[model samples]
Target: MLRQLGSGAQYLATDINQHAAETTQATLEAHGVHADVIVTDIMSGLDKRLAGMVDVAVVNPPYVPTHVEEVGCRGIAASWAVGLNGRQVIDRILPAVREMLSERGWLYMVALEDNDPSDICHLMSEMGNLREMFQIDAADYMMSICGDDSLKELSSPGKSGSIFYLSQDERFVIKTLRKTELKILLKLLPKYYNHVRAYDNTLITNFFWRPQDYSERRKKGSLCCDEKYVLH
Candidate 1:
């Protein structure tokens, strides 16, 4: 990360949004990160600008279904939030990503339960000298947002929030928390500022978890689900 690896030298941060890029640049400068930041739209011929030479990359792809604008939310750099039912986004850049690796680089991507089979496999297959070292179902990060007041209404009785339906964009829309989701959300979400328990899923399953199961996680690492603040 810029904080640890930056070491007062050079680094690069890219975001499609000019505003976000500039804002990140300012924040980096404030923190003394003398790095290059690219604000170009990565969606349009992005692989060309960044063909290869990457040693490592940490990315958190968005979770939302598509390009519809939320009332106040800004979108991620690329339309990287491939719909749960399709593999377009991954299809666009995955091959290029595989080719871009230094033969030692590994793409540490997250696999959401809703992710399509092809995407998940492609996300983990032996690529550029990288084999899956480990895998653990991470705490259900999507359901963690339920604790926020703004999201509480999605849990109200009879609300369609928790219901699973297909989005117009063909992604599975799991609105509310389920038992497994609650189990993880309650466990990992307290670190965020102002988080509190909201609705309990009430659904049950004969499930068990181990500490070592979660030890494999890299919270600060990239290539995980990037759906921060994107879920309704």
Candidate 2:
């Protein structure tokens, strides 16, 4: 996404980690593209100049649930060490997004169940003049099948390297499980099924791999093939 935008626009990549910023620069260079990669906490220094000028804002923030004291840590840990409910950093980002976006701008953010996405959308909708124009659209079975906001949650599998996301209506969680973890999950399905049957309660619903052929998706927009499973 950044690569495509950088080709035709004034693309700037900012990160709190200096190493991350440098790495992004190197990646862009390797791709034969150019961008200003800066090390800054969010949009700290660039706010004033960029305010009301941004057309799109894309964020994949720190949405991992963690201890309150670990919210703003140093090094690579900072990438995922979000405070309680994973909302500390995400909550802060809303106001910054409002300040930086133009009247015609739109924000695309990725959030986990711990981040409370519905609440995030509601809060953003209520911000300034956005209430009339902004609405939440979730991509999930609940939204597609039930057409009502019925969602559920299961215990979080707190693994540092894993990435987790909830369906739009929060009916199911989608995790990027490692190969070994995927193997374990496949082995546990029968036990999980019997346990759920015994209790008559479950948040786990479906699991499958997303097709990685980007030919069709490329017609729609950029191709994002980062995940391997669609677990619910």
| Backbone clashes in model 1, listed as residue pairs | 58-222, 58-223, 59-222, 59-223, 60-226, 61-226, 162-176
How many Å off is the CA of 65 in candidate 1? 3.1
Q: After best superposition, candidate 1 residue 19: deviation in angstroms?
A: 1.6
Clashes of each: 7, 1
Query: For candidate 2, lDDT tens digit of each residue in 23-53?
Result: 8899988987787888876776565466567
Over 4 Å off in model 1, which ranges?
1-3, 6-10, 43-50, 66-87, 123-232
TM-score of 1: 0.40
